[model samples]
Target: MKLFQKLGRMPIGLTIPAFAILLVVFGIPIVLLFLASINAPAFSATNYLGFFAQTANVRVLFQTIEVSVVATSICLIVGYPTAYLIVAASKSVRITLIALVIIPYLTSGLARTYAWIVILGDRGVINNLLLQLGVIHSPLQLIYNTMAVYIGMVHIMLPVMILPLVSAMMGIDRSLTAAARSMGARPLTAFWRVFFPLSLPGVRAGSLLVFVFCLGFYITPAALGGLRDAMLSTFIAAQVKNSFDISRIATSAFILLAIAVAVLFLLGLDLASAQGRTATTAWKSWVVRISKLDMLKRYFSRFSDSYRAKLWTTQLYQAGDDSRLSNIVGTMFVLLVMVYLHSPGLIVIIMSFSSGTFLEFPPSSISLQWYQTFFGDPSWRGAAWTSIQIGVAVAILSTIVGTLAAYGLNRTHPRLRSFLTMTILTPVTIPVIVVAIASYYGLVNLGLIGSRTGIVLAQSTGATGIVVVIVSATLANFDRTLERAAKSMRAGPLQTFWRVTLPLIRPGVIGGAVFAFLHSFDEVVITNLVSGYSIRTLPLKMWENIRNQIDPTIAAVSSLLMLVPVLWLIILYLTWWRSRLRDHRSRPELET
Candidate 1:
C-alpha cells in the first residue's frame, strides 16, 4: 500500500495517454506487420527467400543505398558550412540563417519537386535560359535522370541535414578556436584541426538523418528520375501497390528495417562513446576537487562574471552593430536562399489562382477559378476530407504514443534506453515504401485493406517516430525536479503530471502533433498501398491526377495543401515569439 501510494505520487501527464495511443496505433500495426511477414499460409521462409531470389530486388536495394549515401554526403558537404556559418554569426544573423534553412522544409515536398522539374526539365528555365544565351544549341537532358534525382533529393533533405549540424555546432566552445589561434595556429588551420573535429559528431548525426530520410523519399525521385534511377522505395511501391506481391514486399521491407537498425546502432555507439567520455571526465574532476570548495566557488564566480560580461557586450553590439559589412552580406545571402527555396512553392500557389487553364510562369491574370473548380468537384472534396480525417487521427494517435515513449525514455534508467530510442526512430530510418508494403500485406490478410482505419493506422505508424523526436526534444528542457517537488507535496502522480509536466511540455506536444498531422497529410506512397477504394488521401488523389492527367486542379489542391503546413509553422513561430517576448519582459534590463 505504501509503495503504491508512493508510486501514485509520481507525475503522469500525457505519458499514460501517449503510451495507450502508441499501443493501439503504432504497436499494433508493427505487430501486424511481423505476424503477416511470418504467418503466410505456406510459411517456409519463402517470402524472405524470394526477396533474395530476384537479381532486380538486390539491385534495387543496392541502388537505394547508393542514392541515399550520395544524397546524404552531398547534404553534409553543403549543410556543414552553412551550419558553421550560422553558429558563428551574431544572434540576429543566426536566427535569419536558420530560418533560411528551414523555409524549404515548410513547403509541400511534392510541389517543390515539381518545381525542380520545371527548372531542370528539357524546356525548363535552365535549359531555355542556356539556349537563349547560345551556350548550347540543344537543351540538356537534365530532368528524368540520376542528376535530377540527386538534385531533388539533396534539396528536399537539406533542412534535415542542417538542423542536427547546427545543434551540434552550437554546443562547441567558441573559445576553443581563439585558444588555438593564440597558440599560433592560422584561422583555417585552427578551424580544420580544432573546430572540425568537434563538429564531426554533428556531421555524423546530420548525415545519418539525411541518409535515413532520403532512403524513404518517394515523390522526388519518382517525379525527376528515369526508370533506371528508381530507388528501393519506388521499386517497393511498384511491387506492393501495382503488382500486389505480398511475400516479396515483406522480404524487401525487412531488409530495409535491418539496414536502418544497423546504421542507427553504429551511430548510437558513437554518441554513447562521445557522451561517456565527457561525463566521465567531468565526474572525475568533480570528485578530485571535492575538498576545494572555496577554490571551486571562486572559479565558478569568475566564469559567471566573464560570461555575463560577454553577454552584455554581445547585446550592445546586436542593438547597434548594423555597420558590419560581413553581417550585411551574410543576412542578404540567407534571404536570397530563402527566396530561392520559396519561389517554386510560391509559383505553384500563384498558378493555382490562374485564370488560364494551363500553368504559366507569370499568369496573365489571377483568379480563384481553379480553387472553385477543385472545391466544387466531389472527388477532390472527398479526397481532401478523407486526408483531413486520416491526418487528424494519425496526429492525435502518434502524438500520444510519441509523448509517452519520450517520457518513459526520459525518466527511465540507461539500461535499454538506447535500444528503445533506436526502435522508436526506426520508422524514420527505414524507407516509407518498405513500411507501406509491410503494412499493406498485414492489412490485406486481416481484410482491412482499403479501409479508412487501416490507412490511418499505417500513416500513424510511420509518423510516430517523428512525434517522438519532437516530444523528446521538448522534454529535454524540462526540469525533472518539478515532478519530484509535486510528489513531495503529496500530489498524486497523475495530478503532478497534469498540473506540472503537461503544461510545461505542451508546446513540444503540440509541435509533435502538428508535425505528425502534416506528415500524414502529405503522405502519398504508403496510403496508396494500404488505402482501399473507399479511402483516398489528398496526396494520393493528387498523385493519381498527376499520373493520369495533368490538370490545373492539382495545382489548386497542392496550393491549399501547402498552406496547411505553412499555417502551422506560422502558429509555431508566433508561439515562440510570444514566449520570447514574455521572457524579455520578465528580465530587468529588457523590461526597462
Candidate 2:
C-alpha cells in the first residue's frame, strides 16, 4: 500500500518497468557492441578499416545506397499521384481506398515477398502464362534481378508513402484551392502552386520512412535480387551465418545505422522539433534563406497572371470538354494502381487452392489439398503453435508495459515526454537488422539464445514501442476532467483510474495489443538471429522454406497470413465503433 501510494505520487515511476526492459534487452548490449566494434579499451579504427578494405564490401555498401535511393524515388513517384486521386475522391471512396492501402501495409512483409516469388519465379505465373500463350520460347530471367527487387520493394513500400500523403492532404483547406481557381488560376496551376508545396512535409516524411526501411532491405532484395543486389542487411546476415564474428557484424551494423541516422538527420529533424522555440527559429531561418526565391516567385506570378488573363476565358470554356475524359483517365489510373498493389495477394490466395503439387495461377482442379497438407505436417503445426504462444505472450507483456509508460509520459513534462517517447520508439524506427544484432548480444549475455522467452523479449522491445505510440495517441484525446471529478468525489487514485480512465482508453489498449501481436507474429529478422536455429516459429520456418525450396504448403501459410491484416482491421473498427457509441450515449447525459 505504501509503495503504491509512493508510485502514484511519482507518476514517472510507472515508466520504470518499461525502461528497465528496454535497457536490459537493447540499451546495454548496443553500447557494448559499439565498444567491441572499436576494440574497446584500445579503441582503434582497425575493425572499420578492415571492413572497408575489401572491394566486395565497398561495392555492396554503395549498391545498398543506390538501391535504396531508386526504390524511394519510385515509391514517391507512384504514391504521390495515387494519394492525390484517393484524396480527391468522394468520402466513401476515400475511406475504401485508405483501407485498401492499410491492408497491405499491415500484412506480413514475408508473405508479400513470397507473393512476388509465386508471380515472378522462372516457372512461376508470368513465364507459365507466356509459354501457354506461345508468346515466348523460354522463361525470361525475371525473379532474381534488380528490376524484380524494385518491383517487390515498391509494392511493399507504396502504402507507407501513400498513407502519410493522404493524411497531410486531408488536413489542407479545400477552400484555398477553390479560392485560387476563382482568381482565374487553372486547376493544374492552382494545384501546382497551392497544393504541391503544402504536401512537401508528407513527401519528406514518407520518403525518409521508405529510404530508411530500404536500407534494412533483407527479405525482399535477398529473395528477389541476385547475388550482386545484396544490401547491407543481407550482407550482415550472411556474416552472422557464416561466422559469428561479433566485431565484424557490429561494424557493418553500425555503418548501416550511421547511414540511416544521417538520412534521418537530414529529412526528419523537423519531426522531432517538439519545442516551439526551436521550430520558430528554424522557420525564421528558412524564410530568410528563401527570401530571394520569393522575389523570383513574385515575378513569375506576375508574368503568369498576364498570360492567364489573355487565355483565361478560352481555357475555362475548354475545361468542361475535357472534364469527363480526365475523370475517366484518373479513375483508370487509380484502378490500375490498386490492381498492382493488391493483385499479388489475391493471386497467392487463389493459387493456394490448386490441386497441383506446386503453385500455379489457374488450377487445373481446385481443391483443399494444400491446406490439408499444412494441417498434416507436424513441423508446420508445431511452428504455428509456437508462434501463437510467443505472439500472445508478447502482446500481453507489451500492452501492460507500454500502457503504463504512456500513462506516465502523459503526465510528465512535455519536453521530457517527447524525449522519452523517441527513446522508446527507437527499436521500430531504425533498421530491423540493427535491432536484431543488438538484441542478439543482449540475449547472449542472458544465456537465452535458444529459448522462447528470449524471442518474446526480443519481439516485445519493438512491440512495446508500437503499443506506446498507439495508446499515447488515444490519451492525447482523453477527457481528463472526468478523472478529476471522480477523484473529487472521494475516489482513490486507483478507483478513479479504474472507473474513469480505463474505459475511455480501452479501444486504444485493444488496438495496441492487436498490433503488438502482429509485430511479434510476423517477426523474422530478429527471431532468426536470436532463435539459435533450435526454435522454429512460423515466420522463421516459412522463411527457411522460402530460401531452401519452393513448398506448396507455404502458399497455404501465406494465404492465411494475408487474412491477418483484414482481421486486425475488423477488430479495430469494432473497438472504435463501440467507443463511439458510448460517447454518443453519454452526450445527452452530460447535457442534462
Candidate 3:
C-alpha cells in the first residue's frame, strides 16, 4: 500500500498501455510458439530426435552458421575501419559517413538483394558492362552461387554492423589517443595501441549484432544462392511449408533457438568482462590518488586545484563546440546517406518510368506505361490490396500486443524479466525459415493455410519482437506518475491509459507501428510459406517475378513498396521534430 502510494506520485505516459499491448501481441504468440513446438498428436521425443536424424538438416545448420560468421566477419572488417574513419573525421564528414551507412537501412532487403541479382546475373549489368568493355567475351555465372549470396548479404547487413560500431566508437575517449601521442607515440602507433584496444568492445558488439541478424536472413540467399548454398532458414522453409512436416519444423526451430541462446550468452559475458575491466581500472586510479594525497598535498594542492579548474573549463567549452559541429555534420551526412542508400530504389523508380521494355541505366524519356500497366492488372492490384490489408492489421495488432508485453515485463521486477524479454526477442534471433516452417505446419493442422488472416497472424508474430524493442525503449524513459494521478482522479486503468499515456508516447507507438508495417510489408520468407496461390502479397509477386524472369515491372513494384516505408519514416521524423519544437518552446533550457 505504501509503495502504491509512492508510485501514484510518479508520472505515467505510454508505459503501461504499451506494455499491455506487448503482452497480448508478443508474449502470447511466443508462448504459443513454444507450446506448438512441444505439442503433437502423440507425446513423443520423435520431433526432437527427427531434427538430428537427417544429415542434410545438420549440414544446413552448419552452413547457416558458416555463412553468418563469414558475412559478419566481412561486415566487421569493412564496417570497423569505416566507423573509425567517421569517428576521427570532422563533424560534417562524420555525419555524412554515418548517413551513408544508414541509407541502406531504408531500402528493402528484398529489393536490394534482387538488385544484386541484376548486377551479378549472366546478362546483367556487370556482365554486360564487362563484355562491352572487352573485359570478357563470355558472361560469367556470377548469380546463383555462394559468392552472390555473400555479396548480397554483406551489402544488406553492412549498415547493421556500422551503426553499432559507430555507437561503440562514440563512447571512446578522444583524450586517450591525445595522451598517447603526447607521450612520444606516433599517430598510427597511438591509435593502434590506445584507440584500437578501446574500440575492440565495439567491434565485438557490432560483429555479434550483425552475425545474429544474418543468421536469420532468408531472402538474399534464396534469391542469389544455388541449392548447395541453402542456409538453415531455407531448409526450415522447405521442411515446414513444402513438406508439411510439423515435427521436424518444431525440432529444427528449437535447435536454432538453443544455438542462438548459447551465442548470445557468450557475447553478454564478454561485454560484461570488458566493461568491468574498464570500470575497475578507473576505480584503481581513484584509489591510488586518494592513497598518495597526503605525501604530495602541501606542494601540489594549490597548483592542482588551479590546473583542474582550467582543464574543466576548457573541456566544457570544447565539448559544447563539438556538439554543435556534430549536429550540423550529422544532418548533412544523413542527407548524403539517404541519397546513396536510396540510389538503388531511386534507380528502380527511374526504371519504372522507362519507356523501354528492358532495364537500362537511363530511361529513354519517360512514360506512365508501367504505372498504367501495374494498376490495370487485376492480379497486381489484388496483391497490392492484400499486402496493404495484411500490413495494416499486423501493424496495429503488433503495436497493441507488443506494447502490453513491454509494460508487463518492465513494470514488475520479476526474476523472469530477462528470460521473458529474451523469449520475446526469439522471433528475431531464430531464423525466419524456422518460424515460417513451424507456423506452416501449425496453420495447416488448423486448416488456415493460404488464408490472408493466417499470413497476417504469422507476420504479426515476427513483428512483435520489433514492437517490444521500440515500446520498451519508450517506456524506459517514461515517467510513471501520470497514471497514478489519473487514477486518483477516479479514472479506471483503461481510461487512464487512453487519456494520459497514449498522447505522450504517440511517437513511439507510431514508430513501432511503422516498423511493424514495414516488417509485414517487406516480409518474404514467412509469407512464402503461409500464402496460398490466391493470396500472393506484393513481395511474393516480386519474388515470383525474380524467380521466373527479369522483368522491369518488379522494379516498378519495388519502387512503390519502398516509397511506402520511406514516406512513413519521413512522417514519423516530422512528428518527432514537431514534438521537440513544442518541447523547446515550452522549456528552452530543457531543450538545450
**Per-prediction TM-score to the true structure, in the order listed:** 0.81, 0.94, 0.78
Q: Any runs in candidate 2 off by more than 4 Å, and if so which?
A: 269-307, 313-319
What lDDT would candidate 1 get against the real structure?
Answer: 0.74
Q: Could you report the Cα RMSD, in angstroms, for every candidate shown?
A: 8.9, 2.6, 8.1
lDDT of 3 at 61: 85
- Highest lDDT model number: 2
lDDT tens per residue, model 2, 1-592? 6775677678788888899889999999999999999999899989999999999999999999999999999999999999999999999999999999999999999999999999999898999999999999899899899999999999999999999889878877789999998789778989987787667777877998899889998999989999889899999999999999999999999999999999988666354323323544666568779798877888788867777787876676564757798889989989999999899999999999999877788888899998999999999999999999999999999999999999999999998998898899888878999999999999999999989999999999999999999999999999889888897899888887778898999999999999999999999999999999999999999998999998999999999999998988998998889889988999999999
Q: Once all C-alphas are superposed, what RMSD does model 3 give against the true structure?
A: 8.1
Model 3, position 309: C-alpha lDDT score? 66
Ranking by TM-score: 2, 1, 3
* Residue lDDT tens for model 3, 1-592: 4443444344233244434433443445444556656764455676667666879877888998999999999888777766776787789877767655654676678888777776677877778888989999999999899999988888788888788778778888899898875555555788776777677667776777787778778778989999899977767666654675545666676677677767877766244446845844665567668886656766776677777566655664344666577667755654554453556566677767888878765676788788887888998898888888999999988888787677666665545666667666666766666666656655665677789777877787768778888878887888879788888999876676677777777788888888899889888888887786668888888888888887777777777766765577678879899888876786876666
lDDT of 1 by residue, 483-542 (tens): 899989998766777888887787888888888988888887778877765677778777
C-alpha local distance difference test of each model? 0.74, 0.90, 0.73
Deviation from native of the Cα of residue 101 in model 3, angstroms = 3.1
Give me the displacement of residue 29 in model 3, in angstroms: 9.0
Which lDDT value does model 2 have at 471? Answer: 96
| Candidate with the larger TM-score of 1 and 2 | 2
